[model samples]
Target: MLTRRTALLGATLALPAQAQERFPSRPVTLIVPGAPGGGGDFTARLLAEGLAGPLGQSVPVENRTGGSGNVAASFVARAAPDGYTLLLAYSGTHVANPALFRELAWHPIRSFAPVALLLTAPHVLVIRPDLPARDMAELAAYIRRNPGRVTYASSGVASIQHLGGAMLAQALGTEMVHVPYRGAGPAMSDIIAGRVDMIITTPPAVMGQIQTGAVRAIVQTGRARHPMLPNLPTTAEAGLPGFELEAWFGIYAPAGTPREAVLRLSRDIQGVTETAEFRRKAQEAGTYVTFLGPEELAAFTATELTRWSGIIQGLGIRLD
Candidate 1:
């Protein structure tokens, strides 16, 4: 008499559990919240190619660019909480946007499941060749003496580079004008043309100019020397101790996505990041793989979000 009820309940519970374990029976989409040909796209494409072999499904990259990646981020948050739709979220996704944007429907850490830290690229502080300062110490001293005479340009207002500049200025207890450019290209143009005093740009964006001797890379804002620019000293090495800023990229799933699914994705992402293909591609793009699994990535996000929030408020950065 009791057998019929117990059998059905057992079967019903086991079916979904089995399905969750199998995971990714269909093609998966890796959403890039930024334009193609950028660092975000590069990471997504590489991971998709690498993960396909292990997962036995095609992982395609779909670009959903807008609102500094908030468009794609929001799209993923509302997507089905399955393994099929994933996002290539960055430090910007979790940390920078919270303070930068005026109205975001979803909170970064609250809106997504932590997947893995794909990679990080350090920002390089570059100045026009004509400027007098030769290194970080000299640059800090010069800014202190000149006050607002020196202007630092960023890709745009509230961008990571801008924030880094603000943090740097704050740490040095100095003042420098902040010049907001529409994009990195324009910012670099002004730096090269001597229209702007300096800029902190990504390695790929500024490495060429530094090599060609158009702009001098005074120091990097990373904790250590970059493989691409080993000769250049980090800001800490250049006398601004504890000065480090990294443009980091990671993977995430919509919040409420099953824990098992997030684990599966995180494991596979770890596999992909460890592969030779990922390393080679990242190096070519002026990035390096620094994988952090779900727990670590989540904790890092929390710390970074707090860090960025304070920096934003202290500097009075705002979207509106």
Candidate 2:
């Protein structure tokens, strides 16, 4: 029974199985669900550079825009369960889209497995310099006086920008019109021209406008102030309690990906986030470097989903 031939046969059979355990035997692709030169694209590329050395494989970023980021989400959700194909998921696509669209091709929780959270930044509230509002209180009075005549611009109908504006109006017991534009650039342009009264958007999108005096930043929509905008007060500090909105970015793999591979990637990503160079770059981009492993990321996303769904339902705003 212990013959040399039997031993050789057993060893031969295990060769393929052992070979399959080595992940990253090939290059990895990180898919971005936004256009090039956008914030998401820039962050993805920065992460990709840091990940390549540690992963021992090139991590190329691929952008697939359109359909409100569904094009990229659907593609990643249907890709092979191996770690080779991954998604650079943003809060908008994963958190807001669930409530924005009545039907989605890919499910945030079911279609993909969380790998790691990259960073987080609270949205900034910007208004035209000519607006009489110096802060949220004055803005509320201005809105109450003008009613629906006070309009706010947003990147899209059900975007975070739009939802933030709605929340602000509800908190102030006032009403304001929403002007939906194709993108934040156009929305910012209109606001700078004083065509729109106000806008709520991510920090990076409004930093230039705020610095150049094109728009006045009344408050940041986070519990605490960010280092990038230390002079700006938080909503609670501005006397508007219970107003918080933080944007996050993370990595995800198609569902059913190997557990070991997911864990390995998470650890590798965390290493990159902790580097000094990465932190400096993220801070300069107006985002704080935040890292969450797989389980933590999943739980955080679940809580966000529940919170956003309630807000969306109460507002009765649904987009196809």
Candidate 3:
């Protein structure tokens, strides 16, 4: 026989314990900041499938695409920090957007808790099949000779592809007109059709074209050569030292999410990436699985923000 006051006190005392124990009692949602079947979406689904067993809950991926991931980033920023709502953050959203946009609705660093870094995929230098240049050296020389006449296409203004193109131009000390497109599909289509001179984009985006002889692969933009394209040299070996660049992906929960949950989710994600099946699948998906836990991911994000901000500022890129 307990009095009402006594019962209320007992319930209040148990609330914190209940909250602590109720983590992941239901399914978790991993928000992808891109359309379905895209890299982000593919990574999200892969992690979700692997995370369910360890987290003891169903992890589902939801695509919330628009505004270069702003819509999804904002939604995750405002979501309850119960560890249920997470974001599949990438270079464009977390690292590049802060510098590209004059004012973003949500601060990438402040609005989220870094969970883990999932993978990194390097870009490959490609040119039209009939382009006079045969390799990166020849391409650089050709651009030097052609000067402003040579053109490069990017997915859009301020995109990673654009930044890569800019960096390449800066490295070669050449002037090539930047042609922005709505998306990679259109840009790659134009590249295949010889509407653009060249494009430095991810292999997955143009691997089909390369295989079909629609475009020629010249070099890869990574410290080391990609295993899939062992014959191709890296940018450093291709005569552009210090020209390495790769797009990375990570996971994050909204700021103020439980510290315990963040650590738990980070550990689970690391475990997911360590599995043999996951590694093989990641290789198949054209990305190498690299796991960085919360602390490492946070530091990595900070460094990336700084690096890309410097690059964007140097390039004088701004989107309001």
Q: Pick the candidate with the highest lDDT.
A: 2
State TM-scores per candidate. 0.78, 0.85, 0.86
Which residue window of length 10 is worst by lDDT in model 1? 33-42
Error of 2 at 264 (Å): 2.3
| Overall lDDT per candidate, in order of appearance | 0.81, 0.85, 0.83
Give the TM-score (vs. native) of candidate 3. Answer: 0.86
Off by over 4 Å in 1: 1-22, 128-134, 137-151, 171-197, 212-215, 283-286
Instruction: Itemize residue pairs with steric clashes in candidate 2.
Output: none
For model 3, the stretches where C-alpha displacement exceeds 4 angstroms are: 1-21, 36-38, 181-186, 193-195, 212-214
Winning model by TM-score: 3
TM-score-based ranking, best first?
3, 2, 1
* Pairs clashing within candidate 1: none
Clash tally, candidates in order: 0, 0, 0
Write the residue-wise lDDT of candidate 1 on 1-320 in tens digits.
Answer: 65998988887778866474568788989987655544566678888889998888999999886565677888898999887898888665558888888888778788889989988998889998899988887888888999868899875556676787888788888788889755566678888999999987667567667888999888888888878888889888888887778888888899888898899888888988888878987886667789999999999889989987887788777886
Residues 1-320, model 3: lDDT tens digits:
99999999898888876474667788999997766544566678889999999999999888776676787899999998889999998686678988888788888789999999998988888898889988887888899998888888876667788888888888888778989765566678888888998887766567667777899999998889777778889988988888888988899999999899999999889999999998987876567998998888889998999999998898777788
RMSD per candidate (Å) reads 4.5, 3.3, 3.2
Greater lDDT among 2 and 3 belongs to: 2
